[model samples]
Target: MHNLNAIVVGAGMGGLTAGIALQQAGYTVELYDRVKQLRPAGAAISLWSNGVKVLNRLGLGKAVADIGGQMDRMAYYSSTGETLTEFSLQPLIQDVGQRPYPMARTDLQALLLNRFGAEHLRLDSTCVGIEQDEHSVTAIFEDGHRATGDVLIAADGTRSRLRSEVLGAPIERNYVGYVNWNGLVDAREDLAPKDSWVTYVGDHKRASIMPIGGDRFYFFFDVPLPKGTASQPDLYREELSQFFKGWASPVQLLIQRLDPQTTNRIEIHDIDPLPRLIRGRVALIGDAAHGTAPDLGQGGCQAMEDALVLTNYLQTTNISVEDALSRYQTARLDRVADIIKRARKRSDVTHGKNPETTKQWYANLKHEDGRDIMSAIAHTILSGPLN
Candidate 1:
């Protein structure tokens, strides 16, 4: 019999979502993070219909809807401010049974953390090592304490130590030859239209603007950079201004208002898709399993879906730990791998250096009924494993 205890190795979206699903699946789950407090470190996260579907299973869909901003449409434009294509999000909203919302990444984290009280979560507890045998797993902490559980879930993100232990060396974090900047600007009444999201594409760069809450819009910029380039913190804002000099309207205004401290610059990275996501009593979830560029906004959603299905597998099957882990891997690998591939391809097509070709591609997608495409993808997610 598989024991009903689990240790989750990170407090980010994947870890907390896993804890919730496992605990509710009759497991006693203890979640840990190295950070003293779990505040929102990044800008905003889009709760695509798939993400909200998992949230609905948790009974927090309404809470997410309450705090998140809804958009009826998404429009794409050229850097010269010419409209290229547009699509309605209404069909996707109806298919998921909930409207897609853009909530401040911090706000969503706070809402998820409240589901499990502080007692189940240990802040500032760093997991340094994981030891496992045929039956149980033990986690070694940096503070000189050890805790054992039936299973250890490594959601510790891209630089996972548990991953290193399982694979026997540090896996290289591959950069995509681009860096992204993101921040949430204070809601300016005169700026961005309400209830709509916009993305503007330029040669070798892309910018996204979307509402996250009542007044705030989440903005992201992905700019091309040479591989292995280090960015200077002190000159980020000035560098950004110079990098995007004389782009589009509103975007120029938005960039002008950003506080240097609030903006974050990260080199986009992805791990080559793994052949498997589990090893004995330890299984990897989220980015640890498959990290990819954010071009598709499916990273968090895919992780939440993994957590849900993993819990379902463990609860429904009277199988050994290895069997359960294997089942989880079986259920997730292909779907996630396909997504990773699609996301990489989409990034290439979206930010293609040849502006004319990129424009032609977007035009073709626009004319092909994007709502139908979204519906098909949604069906794949909701019906694939959970059904």
Candidate 2:
């Protein structure tokens, strides 16, 4: 038990996970969020084995399994509905010793909040600045109030104010030159198999459907577009219909069933890897530290990993707080940097930023028997600190 207090900014996955892990480590945790209501930023998260291990370690294994979607296979298809390659995820699951959970973002957030207790989370408090001395760190809020703690964690996400404070420079988020429209729809066989993660790719566009808990499908469509495009919240269905026009029937059906109100559309962006993750008594975690493209589906998973690893260092290290944080940075820097670079490459390839690379990838998928895909997944799962 550390017997210290932690002030965590942002009540998203990483922040809430940090709150729970720190509480378990005998630290009083206070979580603050800018939004009045803590709405999850995404529709669903694909919890790979590494992320699931963190939840299990937090004593939510059964709860997560009960609520998470049971994904048995992963299949890739062309835009015209022709099967490109398919593989059972069972072998990868066995190799990793844990199952992946494709869960709704709201459901996962509710679970974390239940575990960490909603009473400890303070909403409608936006963090504006941070100040720290040799003894403690203080989080300055926009509401003319401040909170001080033994340590402060900046998990405030991609546009983090604390990041600049920690690094002493204003960081810019790079536009990935694509737009993603995502939403949840009722799960039906005609749309996609309830137990499979399916993707349709062609013309530098991607449409994916994954079964989520409660008999629903989490779907996303990716398209190459200029950055800073205005969101068409009211006309999402119409835009999607046109964007994916003349594709497969499953995609059309899914689009037809989508409710415009629930569909979320946003331009994708990510920050370059930070030179460092800590300054004084403040440390950055999750998206604030290393935001990346969602092409690899590791964004939230990496955040969960951040929570567990940071907690482990704080609880197990007998060293000073600053020393422990430096250790955390040392342990995380290389892995996250590699993931960021890989995700960037993947985004480029998937969106046909380089037409030759995209063509090669599609060509390779035709002959892939899933071994190469499974090996890639296995390598990523094995590279985590948990292994």
Candidate 3:
């Protein structure tokens, strides 16, 4: 096992976690990312109990708890300041046996980078292509450097170059029909409850603020928009105001308090679940394998799940690496596919893709007691491999 080498492309959560797990299992690991400096793509990640369990398995539970926000409740609000429903998440925590940690993405990435050992990860090395034979696989970089190993992992993300290579065709990215603007802001009780994830909903749009580390809040605005909606610098606040006009006071405060310089305006998109996650010895993990809309807050969680599943399958030293990868896909493909589809459906509902469903959901929220929401989340957590 010590002689075996694993070449991992992309140093995102999934990639870094896999490298650490594989190294722990006695593989000499080669981790690479195309970026010159590693940074998270989003402001924060809502690490549900399932993801925290993965980090706990990797021995980073304490570190995560330290940086994580104190999110004990999820509350829904109408656009005009009326509370729709609110409930403590204690039952879900008890059901899942772990508390959810909604933390800043930068903090999580830095922790992972530190845990994975920064010296071992190769940065600014863009992996352009991959070559594999029955015995080995090679990752070819754009700079003519190549890393060959016993197995290759493609975790490069939604725009993964290696994903197209594995499928032997161009990958199609489907627009989820909404734009997301997300960033961090200094936490203020007037804007949102410091320990709660509060979302304001109406007119097929959402303005949400969730607690994050360091007394800051992770804020995001979602609106159904035509693809290719133009974004202008210095106008983000005005643009948001127009969209969320007449919303709650807190939503207004969030728009005013957040810094436009650090805010990210992104077109939300997700790839269809691939027909396969493995091609010979090269396996796709994370966004590279199954990119999904963020509606379920499980995008990063699923990637963490991928890291764990891949490592588990490869732990048995006697089995061929190919067989392990095959097993990994067999265990992961359907599960991830189900999640991706479910997330997409959620996006549709949240963004009013089907007006009737969205209307009904809004009506139902008035009488909701949070049982259904917690139950759905608990089901997702318990269905993971660790359970």
Q: Write the per-residue lDDT of candidate 2 for residues 1-387, one digit (tens) a residue.
A: 358899999999999999999999999999999999989988999888998999999999999998799899999999999999998999999999998999999999999999999999999999999988888899999999899998899999988888999899999999998999998999999988899999999999999999889999999999999877776678888888898999999999988888888888878998888899999788899999999999788888899999999988888887678888888999999889888888898899999999999999999999999889888878877899777
Q: List the residue pairs that clash in candidate 3.
A: none
For each of the candidates, the C-alpha root-mean-square deviation to the true structure, in angstroms, is 2.4, 1.0, 0.9
Q: Which ten residues in a row have the lowest lDDT in candidate 3?
A: 310-319
Error of 2 at 315 (Å): 1.0
- Report the candidate with higher lDDT, 1 versus 3: 3
- Model 1 has an lDDT value of 0.79
Per-candidate local distance difference test: 0.79, 0.91, 0.92
**TM-score of every prediction relative to native:** 0.92, 0.98, 0.98
TM-score, predicted candidate 3 vs. hidden true structure: 0.98
**Position 24, candidate 1: lDDT:** 74
Q: For model 3, state the Cα shift of residue 364 in Å.
A: 0.3
Q: How many residue pairs clash in each candidate?
A: 0, 0, 0
- Give the per-residue lDDT of model 1 (tens digit) for 1-387: 444888999888889899888877778998998889887657888877778778889888788888788688777777767776677877776666667788888888888899866688998888999888887899999999898988888998877777777666678877766788898887664456667788777676777788887578888888878777677667877787787787788778877787768788888888878877888888889888888778778788888888887888788877677788889999899888887877777666766645677777766654655665576557645654443
In terms of lDDT, the poorest run of 10 residues in model 2 is 227-236
Which parts of model 3 are misplaced by more than 4 Å?
none
lDDT measured at residue 288 in model 1 versus the true structure, 0 to 100: 85
Ranking by TM-score: 3, 2, 1
